[model samples]
Target chain A: MKKGIFSGLIAVTAIMLIGVIMLTSSANIKNSGSENIAQGIWEIKKEWNNARYLLDKATTDALADSANTGPCTFALDAAKVQHYYMDTIAHIPGCTQAFTVAATAQAGNYQATGTITCSKKISNDFSIKKFEKPAVFTKTVSVQKDMPAAGDCTVIITDAQSGLVEISRVV
Target chain B: MYGENKTGKGFVFSTDAALGIIVVLIAAASMTMLYAPDSSWQKIFQSTSRSMADSAVVGFYMNKVPADMGLETEIPAAVKQGYCGRIYDYNADNGAPGIQSAPMDRNYCGGI
Candidate 1:
């Protein structure tokens, strides 16, 4: 009888240990997914910021030389914008694994808008999960200048789902 | 005397085993309840989304110089021929629903 009791206790303890391991594993998996998504989004944001800085520099150069010419407008070629998009993706850490980035630009009277979209596939390593869908991050920026000369620029950035993220008129 | 106490010993052992099982089950239940998946995911999603949104805003603004400068022209051109693909079409009336109208107001710098 004593032997039987010891055996049962051992079995129960082993089972409990397995339960704890499984619980911890599930938590780790979920946490990993969350961290990856967050990290990807952050990398995209950083790359986008870098591209914007480059665009600003290019625009400043163009504006500085604008005084020589009579009312003339210049825009980056679509291919050039595409090039920047590709370069940004290559440079951003872990972006390629997480999502693909696409950018579109639109020019208006005194303002221009740049839109960036990052998309990814949702999947699990072990099992086939249901309700799996692609996750996307679509961001847009509208930049406007009051005067012709180089100075402060008004910028507004927004996400399709989220209304507005940043709004400032600084150089 | 020994045989008489054997039965009582068996009873005590059985009771101990039952209590041990219950304790294990309670521990398991508590562990499961402590880490709710919904709350964990919710916290992560909110934080990540907010960060992404903030980054988009700042990125757009930083790149605006070139975009605005690229749009600058001495001579006005047709909207169709304008530079960059125009996302928002601003008019005298209600200037672009979501965004703050051009010539930002006093409260423009309030919330991120």
Candidate 2:
């Protein structure tokens, strides 16, 4: 009788151990998914900020000369976009999809807003919850027309979903 | 006396062994779930976000130079012609000379 009872207890313990392993694996999978989402948001923020820089250069060129009729405008060439998009791929570890960015500039008194739409291509499981989200960034710049010196600038990055991460100044 | 106690002690020992195995398994799984690889997703994301923000910071600064220079509207006649692409019709040929390459970054159409 004792021998039979001991064997039964051992079998039950084996089953319980397997169950614990299964539960742990499931949690790990979920964690991986959340990490992907966070990384996606960060990647988009970086691209949008690059677009903002181009807009700033255009603004500076516009104000540099006093006699021009319209603001100085610069078009985003294919090379610029391709260079930035490709460079980021190396930085995002385990990232499979390439990102695309489009910008529409809105110039104000001393500030110019660039509305950027950045998309990432990833597998269904790892893809972000929503594709379209606004990533807003602001830059403060002081421009001097006579001086060809690189002026002081600061950028603020914020997203509707991810919140503020960091403020980087021009290096 | 030995025979009687053998059965009771054996039963208790087997039960204790079963319970201990279950507890250890749970603890092992919990540790694996809670702690494994040390990866900082926040830091990775922050770095990317910083790159984007930095671009805007520089752009804003560079924009002021053009706005201050009054070059916002003052394109050199040669630059304007080059922007037009085709040769400028100096003769009373074309009524309005259309600018070919307009500024894409100039958000405010009205000079900054």
Candidate 3:
């Protein structure tokens, strides 16, 4: 009787060991496959966020450049905005916080590569190599409001008896 | 006779204990296999993937990604890397995706 009981116990232990091994191996395989799919999903999500971020950054940068650095006075500089927006998005060289957009279809071709430290700086290179700081894109500089060089008209009159004076100035 | 009966009874109890232990182990293994990603779990994963694709389509819209570029350049480029799907212009009949009528800056993420 003692011998029979001992053998039965050994059989039960073996069965348990086999079950444990099978369960562990199955779980490992299942987890690895799930991990791969999860990684892929995460990558796609990241790319979408990056694309959106690039677009938003361009818009904000363009607005800041247009409002702060103007090719016009009391008006948003459309030309500057357009130039800044295009150059920022297209990754034109010589722009602060900018990187190159590779023409090839390789991965991460348009990845941003530098720390952006521009505080209160709203101007971009605008890809205008012929003229740096051209008049139309000069930061914090206004077109001369008092430039009356094109034409000027002035009239002055004084009445002799009443000593009344009248003046008209238009430029 | 009584001594033989006692030994037999002892042997039967030991065998019963062994069988009970085996049953317990098998039950535990079956429970684990049950939790593995079944049909419903797969559906969940597919739904999540589709949602991510939808977000990418939204990025194409807003004209930031350039809808024309998405259809012309990106979809093909993405497809090369295990990506599947087509970019359909929003509510178009003639399917000119020919300078896109009225600049429909709309996109869908997944094919189905």
Name the candidate that leads on lDDT: 1
User: Where does model 2 exceed 4 Å of error?
Assistant: A1-3, A62-114, A122-171, B1-112
Instruction: Give the lDDT of residue A146 in candidate 3.
Output: 39
| For model 3 chain B, the run of ten residues with the poorest summed lDDT | B92-101
The per-model DockQ list reads 0.03, 0.02, 0.03
Please give the fraction of native interface contacts (Cα pairs under 8 Å between A and B) kept by each candidate: 0.00, 0.00, 0.00
Q: Give per-residue CA lDDT, model 3, range A1-171, as digits (tens).
A: 454675577666767776786677678666656655554444433333333344334422332232211222223444544453354433322223332221124321112222221212112212222211101111121223233554322222222223333211121
Best by DockQ: 1
Worst 10 residues of 3 chain A by lDDT: A130-139
On DockQ, the stronger of 1 and 2 is 1
lDDT of candidates 1 onward, in order: 0.39, 0.37, 0.37
TM-score of chain B of 1: 0.33
Ranking by TM-score: 2, 3, 1
TM-score to native of every candidate shown: 0.33, 0.34, 0.34
Off by over 4 Å in 3: A5-15, A18-171, B1-14, B33-35, B38-112
TM-score of chain B of 3: 0.38
| Worst-scoring 10-residue span by lDDT in model 2 chain B | B84-93
